[model samples]
Target: MRVLTILLCLLLTGTPARAVQPDEVLPDAALEQRARDISAELRCLVCQNESIDDSDAPLARDLRLLVRERLVAGDGDREVTDFIVARYGEFVLLRPVFGLHTALLWLGPVIVLAFGAVALVRGARRRRQEAGTPALTPEEKARLDAILGQD
Candidate 1:
């Protein structure tokens, strides 16, 4: 019953556990909100699949603090994001910007889809041709006649 109740409560609350400690929160609400927004855009290096705001890893905590520090330093959202990207490279961004460096990353899925579609069309055509009729050679025709006792 306890476990069931606990699961029920967890299902009702969908937000993931945040890594931010109370001490890391700024007194300024607006600055804290900006820091949170920035943190949400950052990928946690220790947990590549999670945003720094959602990850509970130590590196995620550090990243959250760094975002808060940048906000406190009066840096705008873009400036803070660029500063982190400059330091960590583009991998730190959860949503990578499209550019020459990331062109393959952006286009690879479309290219694969196109190739898959072409292969499906070719396969369907081959199956259709095979299903249509048997193109028998002269020797095969004689063999068929022998098998049918018509030779």
Candidate 2:
């Protein structure tokens, strides 16, 4: 039991649990560099926030391979990117294209900030109005004064 426990610990120690993407062995350094550049601009669909080059997902590996293949096949950078974009939509690009469909993506945060600002202004105005109003009525104040035996 002690030996099994020691073996298990040794096996599990310092080994990365995340699966690594397949390394593309490019014939030319320049082609590999281009592939890396393009991959860096592509977002991994499985890991939405991570670039395809950085993600360990199987899908990311496939996309990385696809990019390298296209590069080796003499496709220009723009052509390779366009091919992926056409296949996966603008979501594949780390920075999406500006178009009617993506207007919301570009404007969403600004719209939210504007709405929050309006809400804050309205809330502040409401608070000011409430603060200016007397908490107790004149009659109530008078009653309280009388009850307390004060003028």
Candidate 3:
């Protein structure tokens, strides 16, 4: 039982294996680290949600190679990222930059939440108004009392 528990813990805590191939590693450690960093920020177009560094897709591999190639050719981190963004139209970034064009993306949820809260408040007030009982006139009250007395 102890062995089973230990094995289960080990399996659960194990680090995820990177998808980078042996041949794709750069000869320079600095360049390789930079390449790794850049790949980590890039989303795999084929896999949709997975980072290029963690995706095993062919397009992910190609993008990894492109980052390394750009790094080797003396391009800075920003330059490599910009080049890729230009080609892929910003969808390739794991986290997109906020700008005027992406204002809706950033503020849409807040706007929806505000509208929902207002509607909820209005609905509650409306229900309260509708639930109130109207006051009976003196004549109606007398009639009701007379009917009860007859019963």
Instruction: Identify the candidate with maximal lDDT.
Output: 3
Candidate 1: Cα lDDT at 141 = 96
| Model 1, residue 48: C-alpha shift (Å) | 0.9
Superior by TM-score: candidate 1 or candidate 2: 1
Q: Lowest summed-lDDT stretch of 10 residues in model 3?
A: 142-151
- Assess each prediction's global lDDT (C-alpha) against the native: 0.92, 0.87, 0.95
Candidate 3 off by > 4 Å:
1-7, 137-151
Candidate 3 residue lDDT tens string, 77-151: 999999999999888999889999888988999999999999999999999988898789988888998989953
RMSD of 1: 4.5
What is the descending lDDT order? 3, 1, 2
Error of 1 at 116 (Å): 0.5
lDDT at 107, model 2: 94
Candidate number achieving the greatest TM-score relative to the actual structure: 1
Q: Write the per-residue lDDT of candidate 1 for residues 18-129, one digit (tens) a residue.
A: 8888998999998998899899999999989999988989988988888888888889999999999998999999999999999999999999999999999999999999
lDDT pick, better of 1 and 3? 3
